[model samples]
Target: NTDVTDQRSAEEQSRYLMGELNHRTKNLLAVVQAIARNTARSTMPEAFLDTFAARLGGLAASNDLLVAQDWSSVHLEDLVMGQLRTIGADEDVRVVVGGAPFLVCPQHAQVIGMALHELATNSLKHGALAHPEGRLRIVWTGASSANWKLEWDESLPSALVPPERKGFGHVVMVDMVERALDGVVKLEFRSSGVLWSLNVRGPGVGR
Candidate 1:
């Protein structure tokens, strides 16, 4: 009778672990699906492939950070830098990031990381980072215990005009990322450059 009880307990533990694995697998698949759909906007096959690959790399980096922290929370600075590094933003001397220390919940890190990836890619391709003299400044502000705001401001060359068409980058920032964080996003295109602002509420704040 003792042996049977021990065997049953082991089996139950195995079943529970398997169930948890399945759940996490399903969630991962869902996230990948969303990324695929969002990254399918490029008309050229090569462009699509490149963009998709970079986005996936960003997601992987975010996951790595979350895992390192036991999936509880990650520092906002680490999350930003990880995404930037994955997208090669570290190579640019003109890009700047400054903010008070804060924590990002695991639930929002992936989305926010992806959003930063998209922004950096856009800047490298068409925004400030595309030109030799253009510059980018990213700053965040808020009390540690309340909501926070982050801004991505770019300064371009004198003669550029705003894009007439909305691209995947725009959608990711204004729609997908904003919705995911349950926050608000504002993007403005001025002659100086593009300025993007994100306001995330306290509920989205990590412990």
Candidate 2:
């Protein structure tokens, strides 16, 4: 009787884990589908492959960290640096990240990570990372547990005008972060450059 009970317990645990894995796999696949559709919509026929591949690489980098930690949590600094490093942002340009260490769960980490990837991509293209003389500063502030605000400030050669045709980067920077993280985003135009701010709220803050 005791042996039978133990076997049943083990079987139940196995089934539960398999179900969890299946559910998470579906969720991940949905995210990838969205990325594919959006990337296709925004990229030119000649540029689609490169653009889509790079975006997938960024997403994979975030997933790599989560997998390494067993999806428990990821540090904000690590996510920021990892995403930026993908585009050689750390080595190529003047960049400063200043903030207390922040940690977020897997859901928040994925959104924030993609947001960083998009922001860094834009910076590399037209913002501070584009030129040797330009500069970028990133900072975040929050209380002990919640209400975190992250700011990405840039000092470019001159002010930037939003492109006439917006792209996936814009959607990720604004819409996706807001909707996914339940956060508020503020985009400011400055004389020197652009300021992107995100205020994160809700239950996903990690230890």
Q: By lDDT, who's the top model here? A: 2
Question: lDDT at 138 for candidate 2?
Answer: 87
TM-score of each: 0.85, 0.90
Write down the lDDT that model 1 would get: 0.82
What's the C-alpha lDDT at position 64 in model 1? Answer: 94
| Consecutive 10-residue window with the lowest summed lDDT within model 2 | 198-207
Residue pairs that clash (backbone atoms under 3 angstroms), model 2: none
Candidate 2 lDDT tens digits, 134-177: 99998888835557888999998876766667688888888988
Clashes of 2: 0
Where does the lowest 10-residue lDDT sum fall in candidate 1? 38-47
True-structure Cα RMSD, model 1: 2.7
Return the TM-score for candidate 1, rounded to 2 decimals. 0.85
